[model samples]
Target chain A: MLEIINPSMVSLIQSIIIILSGLVILIASIGILTFDKDMPNIVYVRIHVLGMIDVAGIVVFLALGQYMFAVMYLVLAPFLAHAMANAYFYGEDDYNTLYADDMVEDKYAALNAPDKLDDDAVEDESGEDADSAEGNADETASENLDSGDESND
Target chain B: MEILLISEYFLLVALVIFLISSMRVISYKSVAMGLIGTSSLTLAVTIILVVAGTVLGLGFFKDIALALLLLGVVGTIGFAMVLRRQD
Candidate 1:
């Protein structure tokens, strides 16, 4: 069904396209991991990197002669990205964090929304960075064990 | 019998990415990283599946990639919601 382009030619195209996309994905993966600690909102940066992956992947699919999936992803990718961003900033995700807890109790905090939002974003990034650090596992494991024991009781 | 008619160069690269993203998803503590990593891993798998399946003359791989694509979107939304969920 995909006879529009000669098969051998298609392979040559895919070789160039797929390799490039794969390399892009790899480079972006490195960025995501490497900058996870350094960035203030790593998720936003991740989302952008993922957008690059999406474009590269779509090109790979087009080279593979799969037009439908390429289009499907094109339509859905923005929606998915939006969902992620909205969920991060708007979703009630910060309840467990002490900062969210403090902000929740203060009624007048809404007046400072513009200023506080940036601070909260930075704080959340740092908190999550610390949470994900390799050496911090021992602390989290112990915390989890304590929580598990509490649940058992 | 040789499986795929295509070169193994991209396959090896895809496999490396598959492994790296898999590690990120499992080892990372931040839920957002887990979320992003899982989606990245899914795309990497999709690339591997589509390329290998096409070269091997298997149409099912494309179908599987379709399924993975759909799930990747659904899973991204679910992860975000889970992250946003009130504790």
Candidate 2:
């Protein structure tokens, strides 16, 4: 099967992949075993290490030239990670995580604020927007004046 | 080839790693850490399956690896849900 490509090169890649996958699993195992359980936010740390497991799994698939499995695993690993993450996120009543605490929404608003101001700057710079705003203001003022004239008459 | 020999050695190392991770999974005191260990265990199994398949010339092991991968994700999710409900 590998004769289509350089067999030695393919073997080298597979060897490297297996070695790397072993190292990743070893590290993940250590982290899972030795990480401080007393920390309040330990789940995130655990999840981070577990991500290496997912990466190693993908590489091992690629090493075996199973692109389809690699792609499928890639697509699904995030969902698994997110599940583990959300288990922490929604599980706590006092969940003070940033996502649950509206940090993301606030940051999103903060990020979009400058864009909003930029839109206002565009409105200020564009003659059409400025003219339309002025036109509306003038129409309101003229309507007020006409009402005053009717009252006076 | 030396590369294939080296790959077999690493595959052996990976198998050992898998055993250690499975032991680690059994040893976690905390639920969250246990979940982490579970994920690592599943992933380690997936890696070993591929390694065994490759060295043994069993192409169908890739399909089993794929199934295990999907099962890992599903199993983790299911475990997380159970944990969430308990909390």
Candidate 3:
């Protein structure tokens, strides 16, 4: 019960765990960003960092012997966030190429090459068709108005 | 206090597993692999606390159990949201 738990010891453990976990999380983030490799490696690094956060959150909760509800909420929220992010980012291809500027440029050139049907060409074609349709509609409306005037006269 | 010490030892072991499993999570591109690692870490911590409570007769197992349940719910909902948002 509350009567038996040592508040100071709990606080000390909480502080230590928080510090250690925070350091691990920090290192893991740095490693992740610097680790410019495949998706598996990236995902592994991300999970490691998340694990630190997870442990840190739990330790903090245990340390906060009284504010169980509040700490528990805080802990769950971040875990949920991390899990969602991980699953979303890693659920697809395990080896997504980290597209760099060179890759982007290459993709742009390939997609925009002459004699090929591309998104830009399709957009332009649609735009021109829309304009022509609008012009025809305007002419028809004008003719209708003129006929109406003639009938009135 | 005795329970706290036992919990600390268990947590120490859990931390070791966490650190190792974290590397696997980062290296493996599989979502399942990452989730497995996460589960291992979760289970280790939860079991440690539960065992500590039971061994010490601390009468705090209910609180720990509730926390684990809450974690499970949050994890499921979070995964669902991820699924809904996926392209």
Q: What DockQ does each candidate score versus the true complex, computed on alpha carbons?
A: 0.22, 0.54, 0.06
Cα-based TM-score, every candidate: 0.64, 0.66, 0.32
The residue pairs that clash in candidate 1, if any, are none
Q: Which has the greatest lDDT?
A: 2
Error (Å) of candidate 2 at residue A56 is 1.8
Q: How far in Å is the alpha carbon of A61 misplaced in model 1?
A: 0.3
DockQ of model 3 vs. true complex: 0.06
Candidate 3's residue-wise lDDT over B1-87, tens digit each?
Answer: 554454455454544555564465535565545554455455345544544564466767747755774786467556645753665
Chain B TM-score by candidate, in order shown: 0.75, 0.79, 0.51
Error of 1 at A66 (Å): 1.0
lDDT of 2 at A27: 70
**Superposition error at A140 for model 3 (Å):** 90
lDDT of 3 at A5: 64
Comparing 1 and 2 on TM-score, the stronger one = 2
Output the number of the DockQ-best candidate.
Answer: 2
Alpha-carbon deviation at B72 in model 2, angstroms:
2.5
lDDT of 1 at B29: 65
